[model samples]
Target: MESSSSSYLNLFVQETAFYNRIVLGTLLPDIAWNPLPHFFQTWLRNYIGGTLLYFLSASLWCLYIYQIKRSVYVPKDSIPSNKAMLTQIHFAVKGMPWYTLLPTVTEYVIENGFTKCYSTINDVGWIPYFVYSAIYLVLVEFGIYWMHRLLHDIKPLYKHLHAFHHMYNKQNTLSPFAGLAFHPVDGVLGATPHAMALFVVPMHFRTHIALFFVEAIWTTNIHDCIHGKIWPVMGAGYHSVHHTTYRHNYGHYTVWMDWMFGTLRHPIDDDESKKEF
Candidate 1:
C-alpha cells in the first residue's frame, strides 16, 4: 500500500517542477523579465485570460442566442431591460478580480504538488485516465450541488452573500451578464467545488483547467433562459424555473442531483415559463 501510494505521489510531483519552469519561466516570456513575484505574475496572467474568456464567450453567446436566433428562442416581450443587463454587467465587472483568485490559487497549488493532478494521460495509462476523469466530474457535480444548495438554505449565508445574485430572480431580470454577476465571495464560493475536486480526485491537469473555463460558458448558457429540453441535462429551461421558484433544480450540469434530492421541477410544468427571458 505504501509503495502504491508513493508511486502515485511521485506522479503528482514529477511534472510539478517542469510545469513550474514552463509557467514561471517561459509561458509568459515577457513576464519572465518582469520584477513582480511569480505569484503576482501567475495571478495577472489568469486575470487577463479569464476576463477575456468571459467577455468573448458571453458576448458571442448573447449575440447568437439573444439576437441571431432570438425569434426562435425568445419572445419579443420577454427581453431583459437595459437596466437589468447593465446591473448584471456592473456586478460581474466588480466581482471579476475576486473570481480570478480561484484559478490563481489553483495554479499555485498545482505548481506546489498538493493535488492529485497528473501531467499526462500516459502517466496513469489510458484506462485509468478515462476512469479518473469520470470520477472527477462526478465529484465536482456533487460538490457544486451541495455548495449551491447551502448558499440558499443557510439563512445568514444567503442574506449576506447570495442575496445579490437572487436580485435577478425574474426572467426579464436575467441575461448572459447575470451569469457571473455575483457577490465576490458568492462567486468564489459557487466555484469552490472545482478546486475542492482537485484534492480528492486524480485529474488531468489540462482537463481540469479546461473544465474550469467551460463552467464560465455553461453559466452563461443556463442564464440565457432558452431551454433546449435536453433530458437529464440541466438546460436553461430548468434554470429558469430555479430563478423564478428559487427552491428547485439547483443542479449545475445535470438534473440527476436535483432528481435524486427530490428538488427537480420540470420547465414544462408552466407553459408560460417557455418564454422566459
Candidate 2:
C-alpha cells in the first residue's frame, strides 16, 4: 500500500518540477554562468527567449481583448486616464515572472509529454478536457468572488490589502495592465482560485494552459467599463459598476454569484451612456 508520506512526496516532486520549469527555466533556461562581457550574451538570450516569451503571450492575448472592447463597446475617441495606464504597466512589468508561471506552460508539458505525463490524461478523451476547462473557470470565479468580497467587506483588509486596487475605480482610469496592478497580497488572493484548481481538478493540460490566457484577457475586459449587449454573461460592464459603487458586483467572470447574492447591479441601471467616454 502507498503510504501518506510517499504520496505527498510524489505530489511534491511533480509540483516542484513544474514550478522549477516556470521559475528557473524562464529566468535561466538551458544555460550555465559565463564570465564578464560574454555574460551579456546569456542575458540577452534569456531576455528575448525566456522573458519575452511569457509577457508576449499575455500581451498579445490582452491586445485581442482590447480590440473587442474598443470596437464593440467603447467609442473610438474614448481615452483612458494616464495614471491608471502607467501604474498598470509598471506593475505588469514588475510582475513579468508571474506571467510565465501560470499552469498553462507547466500543464502543457505534462499532457503533451514535453515534460511529464499524468496517468489521468490517459484515462480520458477530448470531451473531458472541455468539461474540465469550464469547471476550472467556474471554480476560479467562485474562489475569487469570496476573496474579493471579503476584501471589500473587511475594513482593515480593504485598507491595507485592496485599497491600492480601488484607486483605479474611476471611469477611463484603466488599461490592459490594470488587471494586474494589484497589491501582492491581493494578487495572491485573486489568483488563489486557479492555483487551487490546478492541484485538485482532473483537467487536461491544453485546456488548463489555454484558460490562464483567457482569464488574463477577461480581467482586462472587466476593467474596460464598456457594457456590451451580453455584458451580463461577459461581465465587463457590471464589473465597472462594482468599481464605481464600491459595494456591489463582486463576481469574478460571471454575474451568477452577484445575482444570487443580490449584489448584482445592471449596467444600464447604472447609466450606460456616460461609461464609454
Ten contiguous residues minimizing lDDT sum, candidate 2: 33-42
lDDT of 1 by residue, 114-204 (tens): 8888778888999999999999889888998999899999999999999999898877888888899999999999999999988998889
Q: Which residue ranges in model 2 land beyond 4 Å of their true spot?
A: 1-29, 32-78, 98-121, 270-277
Best lDDT goes to which candidate? Answer: 1
Q: In candidate 1, which residue pairs get closer than 3 Å at backbone N, Cα or C atoms, i.e. clash?
A: none
Evaluated at residue 176, the lDDT of candidate 2 is 50
Worst 10 residues of 1 by lDDT: 268-277
On residues 1-277, what C-alpha lDDT tens digit does candidate 2 reach at each position? 4575456335534553454455445666445422323223323333334344435554664456456445765555554655657777777566544443444334433433333223445457667766766776777778888889999999999999788888877666755557766776676667667657665566654455446556666776667665665644746677777888988889977777776676777777645423421
C-alpha positional error of residue 252 in candidate 1 after TM-score superposition, expressed in Å: 0.3
Instruction: Please give the lDDT score for candidate 2.
Output: 0.61
After aligning candidate 2 to the native by TM-score, how far in Å is the CA of 3 from where it should be?
14
- Specify the highest-TM-score model's number: 1
lDDT of 1 at 5: 64
